[model samples]
Target: MDRRAFLTAKKSKQPASVKPLPLEGRTSTGLAVYTGAWTKSEITHLLKRTMFGARIDDINYFAAKTMGEAVDELLNPVAALPNPPLKDYDGVTGAATPDNDVANGATWINSVNNDGTIQSRRRASFKKWWMGCLLQQDRSIREKMTLFWHNHFATETVDVSNANLLYKHANLLRTKALGNFKQLVRDITLDPAMLVYLNGRSNTATAPDENYARELQELFTLGKENNPNYTEADVKAAAKILTGWRVDTTVNTFPSYFTSSRHDATTKTFSSFYNNTTVTGRTGTTAGDLELDDLLNMIFAKNVEVSRFMAKKLYRFFVHYDIDAAADANVIEPLALILRTNNWDIKPALTTLFKSEHFFDVLNRGAMIKSPIDHAVALCREWEVVFPTAAAEYADTYGMWNYIMSVAANNQQSIGDPPNVAGWPAYYQVPQYYELWVNTDTLPKRNQFSDLMIGNGYTRNGKKIVIDAVAFTKKLSNPGDPNELINELFEILFQIPLSQQVKDQLKKDFLLTGQDSDYYWTNAWNIYIASPVTANYNVVNTRLRGLFKYCMNLAEYQLA
Candidate 1:
């Protein structure tokens, strides 16, 4: 009984009774309050929550919108930018050109030859393009989703240094970012980077590596602890079934093919839990490829396991982590049903989750803390601050853009690479993710970055870019009514209502600034805009420094 026969039989079998909930009702935990309008504070909170931080343009854009409109836009963003064409890695014409000899001097001089130089150039180009996407791309959701999948797939550069291999993997993720989950999984299993990362490069009949096979079941498909659907026997059997896949480095491209000679031509068997199948005599010239496909079919054939596992992970990533058995039966089960019904179409499943009433529940709001990448990207977007241009002229220049990447790297939040195959540990724990993202060290760094942004120490090139406090204040139509202004600001900053005490405190702080209402509001805006004042700058530098110190010290800075 091979994997295919096993899976086909499993699908036909009926599952146990499990009562599912309505797609719109609250979880077992109960419902959250429905705040009427989104304010500046709310926009700020939203920016902090959904993205890295607020950019000036993003803040203004949300500030002008109503609550329903803002939520709608976030759920179904129209501004997503298309992925740019990837440069070839073969050093053929139109491939990403090598940096100057001077740039490659140290690494190349120490290495054996041109191979090292080419690899170095490819690495540099890859990093630049990835970072560029963060700074300049208009599509926020695609980038966000890319990051999500990157963690989920968890491939590393150590296995495949060929730029083409990495780029191909990345392109696949971009293309299928919001597509079908089944296809995405199938596509990833064949990716060259993934093949190399998981030791599938040498998976063959003589010696099979269980690395990829085990992880596919335990990590990617069905999680370990919550759902122990597959056993050790299943893993060993799957490994034998998966042998024979290999990379064609001659092309220096991705989507590696199968080498028939290397495939294991033996039958495999699983435990009684897996329907007690004796998968045998299935091997042929196309054994490896067919066996792998058969294995996936068998896995998906167990609809209950995939459904429960995916729902839990998706809930942790997109909603709350805490799971009640009743809620799982209701929300998770129903969403899983959609996936099963639609052959695992990811977009529809996600769309269903977003539109579901439970998504907007107050309890789900502010449940997740901003990951480091989210925090950084949101700041750039909300402030509308222009990052470094990627032209040939200033390729060596270093400042905030460099600093931003450095900070991210330091915080163990590199965009392209995660800590391991498992992904960021904090995201797995649920509500504790809020506490997990920050600690004594990271909290201060977060504040320091905020202060740098609000103070005059920060700059683009050599020129001082003013945040235009007056312009921000003038955007408000009702300067006379402090409460209205605060409410309006909150609408721009966060998508949730501010408590009366928080509003009053902000109002009192604005009044103490000694400027007129409009002036004071504008000044505060300026402080947030022109942060990180360096010594020996301009006149506004001192004021910006003082204001930044005060603002970063505030507890509100940590919330978003």
Candidate 2:
């Protein structure tokens, strides 16, 4: 039967014609293939890849829907952005003069208003708040895409020291997360936080800085070697065009503005790289806007390089990090075609990819090593972890932000403060792209954090009851059945394949207490469900915790 009809009739008797996609070494061709009956395994794979973690109820819902419905639910986000509601710090109302020694007034202003201790506190709070957003995911892809864009156009809050502006920059990213890429680049260019961070505020016609301009081309758009594409001359011209932008973090409204006089009004010429193009100079209030549009038009018009660069980045993000020859031929090329055909609207292309057969290839499943965020957030969701409030987490001891930030930060993926401008080395670095996420330094920290949560539960601010494995099991569809509990937990927690002996060994050790019969586990769990007392709870809870922690601590749990 077809996938849709089978989903509607019954899932238990579902028959599927799913063959693993022709992939090896974690890469496959990009062609679409017909789908068959969807199983729980398929649902498990879908949710883990798309959402942070899968809830059993959510999995059942998607399993009932058709392919279009499932893809649309994810593609079209319908949730509101988190309301951090940060104060807009005013630095311009009564500013310090350039007292001869104060030539760089922006840096001076930041130093005066932003105390080091306060700045560090605000950054920590922001990281925790963002972690909650990642954990809850009230809206799905926005947070995911915000992170994607953060890494894509990385800027550290330490460099952009104004918390309000950092908050403002984050809002811009989250709002425009799934919107137009061309527009996102335009907005990012003028964002006050970015302006101050990348020294775009200091960029001028007299002394143009190529920091933002070079990254705009190299990191955001054209990658390295696109023929007839870009050059050093192009970067210089772009810098001149982007000059005269300023940030007034002092004001609540209109923090970022253009200084018309500071803008370069000289005609900028391009090499044969861009058909020997020339952008006409203007001397008015609209000069910056006009030049920006002209520049974006020049870049976006070369759809091939721009499209491929974005497709490759997104694929590496959601799928495997390393792209093999088969992936290049099948995946990247065709995905880029979809982007070009859609006027750079991201939804259609992403929808096409996520719902395609290539996405569900058996070889492709769990091929990616989990980033710190993936590892921390997924486990917390499974364990039903709860932490203190972050609406305005105090910077004192045992703050929720403190715990969350330190957890991810210690694991080598600091939330708000990525290592540098080029983002965490894992995303951009070669050969050992994802391998960089784990090292001697990070693995022990990861293990320690996992042990803390699984063993003691995150009890802070008078909050406890972290991972009640006994209660977790009782809520399952077939908790009294030992084999059922083992399979179900494995399905929920582990991503990689396991052998029958491995499954039997788990059953023998954790649930059955070395007995060959499943009755030991069944009687223990059934007694707990019936009595609901401390002794019964402990009897089942202890075994469940041991098993749950063991599964999570396994290497397979390190993948999505």
Candidate 3:
């Protein structure tokens, strides 16, 4: 559409009707009260929760809007775009070549090489595009959903040197991330990277590898704890069913000319858990493709397994990890109902969760720690920062981000590659996962990041990255009273109302600084950016520095 027509069309769209807030008497005692229609705190909370985090500019833009309006914009973002496809490699067909020796640590490169040019370029491009997507992608839902699926169908490059195939698999996940859970599962099973990683390539008639098949049941389809319906026999049978699927290492294709010569045409049987009729067709000889489809059909026909499996995982991811009996009946069961009814349509399940009253409950807010990816992405979104242009510069920024991921990984929360195929141990209800996230090692790192960002202590090289605090102050139309400004900042940062003690501390700290409230606030932030003692040369000694130290040391800084 032309710009003029687009503007006219947008203007023509009617505003959604606003719902009145429930009365204090009708609402729960713990529910927060809003003094005005909308405030900066609410906007900040929405941004932080919906995106990664919010910047001062982000808070200012939506501060005056109602919660409903702000959330609507987030859930249905305008900027998010579809993931683009990777450029295909030339002269490299799907055939098993010697794995890159450097990648395998079999040979070391003293310097960059002229040979292996295509492979090197592909790897670089893949990293650049992957980071770009996280930093610059317009589609928020797609990006977020891609991250979710990346974890769901977790595969690493440790085993696969074919960068093109890896990129293809990653793109596939992004493209179908939010589309259909069933289709995604089917595609991943056949994905070349997955095929290689899970021994799908080695799954043959003589001896079928049970790795992928076992995970398909125990980890992917059913909850390891509650649903143990399938047995060892079932896994072996499923493995046999999957044999003859192999990657064409040359072109990165799959189900390569299933050698009927090498095929295990033997019929396989499973317990009552699986429909016996589905596998009966494979008696003497069956096409590999038909057998695979029958297996998927059989799995899908047992809707109970998929629904229960998906609903539980979704609950742990979006909601709290703990699932009560009542929640199972009310939230989880309903989610499963929608999933099955919609034929495993993911968006519907997500929409149901987002629209539910339970989603907006006070207890659920600030419940999750900002995962490393969450923290990095939130910072970029809030500040509207772009990735650095230079590769070395990009690497430095990525190093900082990766350092955080490493800390989380040490705490058992890596984003790209989790601990195992089962994914970050935390997703499961492991006590150690929670305990690991806040040990002595990780707490200091988390505090350091908070001090650097919120406290304003970040730097590049020897120089401090200055925040434009004066510009921020001038942007506020109504400067209002000190109390109002503090309230606004609190709302934006915390989302929930601040306790009286915390509020009083902020006021007292503001008074002690003695500069104009705005300037002091700004400089206090500058102090935060300089708190890392090893990076201390980037910041000078100042009162704001001292205050930055004080605020970051507080317990509240630990929350999302």
lDDT, candidates in the order shown: 0.60, 0.73, 0.57
Q: Judged by TM-score relative to the true structure, which candidate is superior, 2 or 3?
A: 2
Deviating ranges (above 4 Å) for candidate 3 = 1-50, 55-132, 137-139, 226-228, 252-262, 280-286, 383-386, 389-411, 432-435, 453-481, 511-553
Candidate 3 lDDT tens digits, 1-560 = 01121121111111233222233321121112222334454355445555556666656566656655555555555654534323323323442442343332111212122235445545544544565566565524566667777777777654555565667777788778777888888888888778888888888888889999998877776656645477788889899888877776444342234545455677878877774544643533456668878777777777877787888887666655656555565567777888999998887777666545445544555555566566545544443443344533544444344443444455445544556687765567464433345567767766666556544535546434322333333344432344555555455445445577766566556523544355544444444444535343232234334444454455444445
Q: Which portions of model 1 show Cα errors greater than 4 Å?
A: 1-114, 117-121, 226-228, 278-285, 390-401, 457-485, 494-498, 510-556
What lDDT score goes with residue 8 in model 2? 22
Ordered from best to worst TM-score, the candidate numbers read 2, 1, 3
Better of 2 and 3 by lDDT: 2
TM-score of each: 0.77, 0.88, 0.74
Candidate 3 TM-score, true structure as reference = 0.74
For residue 520, give model 2's deviation from the true position in Å.
Answer: 0.7
lDDT of 1 by residue, 56-115 (tens): 566668778765556556645466554442222334333353424323212221221225
Cα lDDT tens digits for candidate 2, 103-135 = 211122222244455555456556666776777
The local distance difference test score of model 3 is: 0.57
lDDT, candidate 1, residue 117?
47
